[model samples]
Target: MKKENNLDKITRKEAISKMGKYAALTAIGTFVVLNPLKAAQSSTPPDDTGGNPFD
Candidate 1:
């Protein structure tokens, strides 16, 4: 039978740190991937021509 190794044992602090790091990395990755596309999208312009979809 194989025994558990010391390295496999994780302490409370290590677990918390790992979770925080993972959350930060995930946030950064999402921002890095989506921010550019969001910035490139054009905002709604004012309709000076006075035309409405209902009209």
Candidate 2:
């Protein structure tokens, strides 16, 4: 059997750091993509009457 080398193994800290970076990037990307839609939806004035606007 071949012995495993320490240099080839990933440490817990390194794994956690990589995961954190991916999470942060995903969050930023999601926000960027959704922010425009959110703004557009909010720009429309709300109807005071209790009726569906789409009707």
TM-scores, all models, native as reference: 0.61, 0.66
Per-residue lDDT tens digits for candidate 1, residues 1-55, read: 9887998799999999999999999999999999988877866666688677687
Off by more than 4 A, model 2: 45-55
Candidate 2 C-alpha lDDT tens digits along 1-55: 9988889889899999999999999999999999999999889786699888799
Model 2 clashes, total count: 0
| lDDT scores in order | 0.89, 0.94
* Residue 5 accuracy (lDDT) in model 1: 95
Candidate 1: segments with Cα more than 4 A from true spot: 1-4, 43-55
In terms of TM-score, which candidate is strongest?
A: 2
Pick the lDDT winner: 2
Error of 2 at 29 (Å): 0.6
lDDT for model 1, please: 0.89
TM-score of model 2 vs. true structure: 0.66
